[model samples]
Structure formats: C-alpha cells, structure tokens
Target: MDKNILGNNVITQIGILVHDIEKTSQAYADFFGIDKPDWSMTDTADIAQTEYRKQPTQARVKLAFFDMGSLQLELIEPDHNPSTWREYLNEHGEGPHHIAFVINGMKGKVAMMERNQMPLLQKGEYTGGRYAYMDTFNDLKIILELLEND
Candidate 1:
C-alpha cells in the first residue's frame, strides 16, 4: 500500500497560539468582522506528557475556534506549564503554531510516521474526529491532523 504522505490534503484549519483566547478571538472578530466562534478548554496533561515529544511538562491549553469563511482558525494558549505555544510566543509573539489538515487515515498515517521515526505529539479521537501531531522539523514545530470518519 502507498503510505499517505503529509500535505496530501487541504489544510482545514490552522491553530494559532495566543495568551488570551477572548481578546485574541475578539481581534479576529474585529479584523474579519465576523462573530466569535466557539471556545473550549482541555487539560491535555496526559496527552501532552505522553504524545507530544517537544511539549513542555504538564502542558495545558485553552483553545478557541473561529470559522473564517471557508476555513477554521484555532486559538490556543498554554497554561499550567509552558508549552510549544508559550515558547513560540516568547520567541516571536503570537503566531501560527501548527497547520492542521484533513486526512484519509489518521491512524495509518500516524503509524507510517512512527515507522519513519517521526514521533507523534498526540493521538486521540475528539468530537468524532481522529487527531494526531508529529514533529519532523528541528524547531519543535509539528503538523496537526483530522482523519476522515471511517
């Protein structure tokens, strides 16, 4: 079977790290003149500690999502302990953390990456979608994904 390669699909969403979810959401709302999208918080302690290789210890995140016309934007903030987002913010201020794509097979994709020595940042199912993260670059950066419902 041909292993599905990364970037073989469209980027459905991009997660931007921010310190303030509401304020950041507002900025996007005003900038795009669109209403704020739904928001939620996740513990992520276990997922972060286990899955994310470059993640800071005890990683916690407060995230919000915004629908931008044809795409979606996710705003994330690292709390509890510092995270890749915090580090990125410290180095370059608020900006893109990871670009998420919709994939055909998430587990298979992740397994392929694993066999290739690329570690997964996280792997689990949420809201009926399979998600995973992997860091291939040196900057502790990674790609996020959403698997098509099987």
Candidate 2:
C-alpha cells in the first residue's frame, strides 16, 4: 500500500455523514457505551471561506464529536448546502465518510495528495485548526481528511 503524504498512517478521526446528528450520535453513543457527543454548527463567518471543488463556496454542517479513546468519531449533518458531507449522503447514504490524519505541514501534505491524483473536495477552518478533504475514494475507498491544529 502507498504511504500517506505525511508518511504517517495514524488515523485520528472517522467521520460519518448523517441525515440527523442527534439520532446518529445517540446511536453511536449507545453502541459504544459512551456519553452523547457534543454538537456544534459550523459558524456562518467560516462558511464564507469554505472551498468546494477548488472554488470558494458556501456550506454548513452540524457536527458532533465523540471521543473514543485515542480516536474521535465525528458525525456530520449537511445543512442545505453543497458540500462533501452532502455529496456523500446523496451518493452513498449514511455511513463512514472519511478517515482523517492530523499532520504538521498540512498545506504540503495536501499538495502531495493532490499530486498523487487525490484532488481536494472541500476545506474549511474551525477553532484552533483547519482541515481539507481529498477525493481519494477511488484509491482508498474512503475520503481522506488532512487536519492541522494551530
């Protein structure tokens, strides 16, 4: 198998696209015997800077983060916008959407992935961090997310 752009194989998060954040989060919590995940909506100001298919576009999602030991489980509910989460839900239904790796040089790693034929799908910033999703489903059978915490 090919090594990742960062030369590390650690997956920090597994993201799931869902139609309803509350329902899916509860199901995951019950299944894993954990407390309900905390929910947050993407800020409107940040949505303006989001990019989809390499163009600045508007997208919003409701997110729920569940801490599971060393990894995090993220539930995403697309909020009436064209985004990676919505595309996944439309094409594949609700399930695993992406596997994310936290890296140091996020821009360099993202460029490497793009050079390797994994074009960027979407990107946005959040508190203390930013992320980019790559279209690597054909090769890896799942989207790959690159995260950088500042």
Candidate 3:
C-alpha cells in the first residue's frame, strides 16, 4: 500500500536554465573535457501539446544534453513563452531548474504528486516520450520532472 511516486529514487537528469545555451553548454563541455553537444529546440505547441498551469500554450526551448555517466545534464534556453522554463528563468535568472527521473505510469505518478500537494506546473510530449514538471520547490527545495518514455 506504499510506494514512492516516482517508483524509485534514481535521478536520471538535471535540467539547467540558461540565457544562452551555446555558451553554457560549451562551458560545461570545457569543464568536463567533453565535446560540446549540439542543441535543438523543443517542438511547437501543436506537436508537444504543451500545457502551462492548465492552459495550452506555445512554449518551447533550446535544449542540449551532456551524458554524465548515469545522469544527463540538460541546458535549456527558453523563448519568452508562457512555460515552466521561461517562468523559472525570468524569476530566478539562470540556474538549475529541475531534477528528473525516468518513470512509467505517468498518470499515476502525476496523481500521486498532486495528492501530496505538489501540483503539476507544466507538461508536454516529445518524440518518443512525455514529461511533467511538479511544483516541489517548497518541500524538496527543487522542482521535479517525470519523464515517461514510450
């Protein structure tokens, strides 16, 4: 009768918001001694079906990822859209955004999180999977992202 909402405690990724992804990614690469990874933009709202605080919105971001052993470090540059990424960037400047976990049963996980008072801030679908951001900062000191690959 008891289970963690994420199903496990393994953090698969750490998402960082940046004003300039290219510069940040390069900095990470140089610091880590790895090649700078290419960045891509998130799909438009039509494709991603992005929702921010229950309203559908055209929010997208430039994204780049660095494979760091078992965890991936993500750099995100938001477009001025009404989205989690943009909001976080505007409010906090450039900094860490969310800690992500790969999980199954997206609906169940989201419901559990909401019941625990951590409401969903945003959600969207990508090519092969979907992601949800939970408002866990007050309790966990950080936002949490649930990634469900299908």
Candidate 4:
C-alpha cells in the first residue's frame, strides 16, 4: 500500500457531532470571539441519495462551518434518523466525529481505505460533491471523511 494514498495528509476539515447546532455554534463563536456562522440543512433524500450501513436511508443533518485559515471546523447536528452521525452522537455523545480530506477520485480512495482495513460506513451526495465516511475509528480513533468534488 502506498503511504501517500491520502495525498500528503492534508486535512481540510475537522467534523464534530453536536446535539444542538445553534447552541454549539454560539458557544464556539463566543468562546473564540468569532462571529457565529449560519447553519444549513443538508440536501433531501431524493437529491442526496444517502446510504447508511449499506441500506438506503433518509438521514439528514444541519451543518455549520467555521473557517480558520486553511482548516475548517464543521459542526454537525443530525436529525432523529439512521445515519453515521446519529450513531456516533448516540454512542459517543457530542464530540469529535471525523477528519476530512478532499481527494480527487473517490472510488479509488474508498478502495484504498477499505484495503487498509477501514471499510465505508456511510456515504451521500451533496450539491457539488459527494462524501464517504470510513470506519477508521478502530485504527485511527476517528472516522475519515473523504470528499470528492465533481
């Protein structure tokens, strides 16, 4: 396996699962003295075509982004549906969820992740891109989110 498969370890974002998006966004902004970012809901089931644990699902979440130079901090608040975010929040509570890397080819990267013992847990389509959550917690202590822009 190539050690540079993830492309130089450039992490574009750090995702955190939260119970309340408004509250958490306020807390982060207030604590850091930065402006609170507006949160937005993800795409609907029809557009997203989300899959969780190998099954078609309608799971969605609200997302807020805090830009800090090159690294973005993403806050996620999931609805009461079946999803990787819900599973993590339920099992681990509000905390760090995943670290994301923007890659070129998602299919190849996913295969590499799987070959490295990190199987895919969930995936979904966004407006201009798609994302996959790799089950790397056992090895890396956090899920790996691979974003592929189209």
**CA lDDT of each prediction against the hidden true structure:** 0.67, 0.85, 0.93, 0.94
lDDT of 2: 0.85
By TM-score, how accurate is candidate 4? 0.96
lDDT of 3 by residue, 34-144 (tens): 999999999988999999999999888999999998999999999987999999888899999999999999999999899889999999999999999999999899999
My TM-score estimates for the predictions, one after another, are 0.72, 0.92, 0.97, 0.96
- Candidate 4 per-residue lDDT over residues 1-150, each given as its tens digit: 548777758999999999999999999999999999999999998999999988999999999999999999999999999999999999999999999999998999989988988899999999899999999888789999999988
Q: Model 2 segments beyond 4 Å from truth?
A: 1-4, 45-48
Instruction: For residue 34, give model 3's deviation from the true position in Å.
Output: 1.1
Candidate 2 lDDT by residue in tens digits, 17-86 = 8998999889988998888967998877454478888777678889999888899888889877778888
Candidate 1, residue 61: CA error in Å?
2.2
Off by over 4 Å in 3: 1-3
* Residue pairs with clashing backbones, model 4: none
Ordered from best to worst TM-score, the candidate numbers read: 3, 4, 2, 1
Whole-model alpha-carbon lDDT for candidate 1 = 0.67
Instruction: Return the top candidate by TM-score.
Output: 3
lDDT of 1 at 60: 61
